[model samples]
Target: MIRFLTYPLVILFLILTAVQVPQVFTNALASWQIYTPLIGGVLGYFVLSIIPFVSRNREHMITFSHEMTHWVFSLLFFRKLYSFQVESDNTGSITHSGGRIGEMFISLSPYCVPLFTVILLLVRHMVSRDYLVGFDVALGVTLGFHIGCFINYTGLYQSDIRNVGIFRSLVFIIGFWLFFAILILLSLKSDMYVACKGIFLRYWDTLVSFWQFVKGLL
Candidate 1:
């Protein structure tokens, strides 16, 4: 059942965070740098996707994705959903009830996390670690979908942002995204420890050097 899956999913999330978060902290760029090609494609797709004619028709898709993201987190956290809806004109909402942590994730997910990409990554992870050929294409497209929809929807004021203070919203969204980004990067690489250490030693040294130079100037 869906509820049963939540237990496993939570474990998976924690395991990933344990390895990837510290790795990213030591070397933040490693989390995203390897995805440069795929990210470029995703960004390029975003440019083409935002043309009014292209975007207008896809409004419903965007709206559905937004609500579905909230719905997903709600389900993942075992929250109760009262209702979910998406209109033809790219407008939608989901009503759910849960604890503070779940409430934050359910309300703020649309702006920060890409549910489709996360879902795709999960599907890929479950099926085969190394057998997924051309997985990058699927990953890029869903990532583009997330970026495009995130840009369009977040331009307006949403009730979700108001519920969580703007500062808290950015911190939560960014911190959550960084955690998973590291996980995604680790999965793509053969040497995760090297990647993690790269962040800590190489990047840390560069940062320290930069700081020392700045101090000399002062």
Candidate 2:
């Protein structure tokens, strides 16, 4: 019952975010080319992923990353945390007080988002353009780390996805990732700000047109 209901709600949430978050972003990058320093970061991330195959602590680190992401999302959603721990058996958990919706978001966030990636991206903003070389490297590294972690975590047993139902989880994940990606791009490319505004308008128009089409049949 709750699972089925969450489907439409997830769609509505995505539609709402798609129509709104892009509005506040007043910047965009001139180009999407991968900068050289970003390659450094990417390489670092790739190396880390491969190293895990031979490392003894890889499982523990991944578990820690997963749990830490939960904690981060908990904090972001205004949740109060009473405890968090990572066990030697490569298991971890967090106890936090939050709304049901917030709890749902917290559980699934790590799967779609790499907390470290966001942290590095945020840190990149603080550095000057003159120093962006280093920042880009860090960005690539974090991006790669996100990719690696996402790949590893997706197949393993995930309580988050099961709780929401896989179909709904995938829908929400797509929406969440799309929203964040657009937001990030818009924040970098100010020139596209106007186009960004038009984007959701077109999307809404399409939805409205579809609804009308459906109604004409009935």
Candidate 3:
């Protein structure tokens, strides 16, 4: 029942994100101070990816991050985390008990959340202004790793997407990716509060325009 109701919201979210694409890209491209390091980080991932050792070892990071995301969301929803395990083959599992909504989040979050990015964002203020570019480089590297691994990990056959339904999962993931990208760009320009406010205003404006379009159709 909840899933049924969630479909429209997810679709609407996708639409709202799509509408904000211009602004997000504009913001992202506007600052060389931000984008330069980010691009360097992304390129660093690609360079590391070509190395046999780094490529092989990355499985551990990927699997750990995947299951950890599940575990973290499980905690967020106050679910008990049971056994967590990562295999030698770049596969992992997290057992947690939770409500249906929480279950959905736990299952699907790793695909969209970028766990390391969140960690960096939290501790970002700790770094001095001079080393901020270094931090952004790290951010970019993690983002590159996440994007690279996400493509390698998630798919139609994956239990997480299958359990949630593929269409819904894709919509949810894409929406969150755009949403997070906007947040990341905004963060580059301003503080967290301002970034959040920017997101809210963008979403609110898009929602209002959408509402008016629907009313006109009616």
Give all TM-scores, in the order shown.
0.64, 0.70, 0.91
Q: State the lDDT of candidate 1 residue by residue for 1-218, as single tens digits.
A: 44344444444444444444664546546466656655665766677677898677677878888889889989989989999988766678888776745666787888878777776666664556464545655677778888777666673277787776565565566555665566556545534345455534644565567689999999
- Model 1: pairs clashing at backbone N, Cα or C within 3 Å: 26-199, 26-200, 27-199
Model 3 — TM-score against the truth? Answer: 0.91
Worst 10 residues of 1 by lDDT: 11-20
Q: Residues 62-91, candidate 2: write the lDDT tens digits.
A: 788888999988998998999999999999
Q: For each candidate, how many residue pairs have backbone atoms clashing (under 3 Å)?
A: 3, 12, 0
| Of candidates 3 and 1, the better by lDDT | 3
Rank by lDDT (best first): 3, 2, 1
Give the Cα error of residue 195 in candidate 2, in Å: 12
Stretches > 4 Å off in candidate 3? 212-218
Number of clashing residue pairs, candidate 1: 3
Q: Which candidate, 2 or 3, has the higher TM-score?
A: 3
Writing each residue's lDDT as its tens digit, candidate 3 over 68-116 gives 9989999999998789999988778988776866667788899998888
Evaluated at residue 125, the lDDT of candidate 1 is 46
How would you order the candidates by TM-score, starting with the best?
A: 3, 2, 1
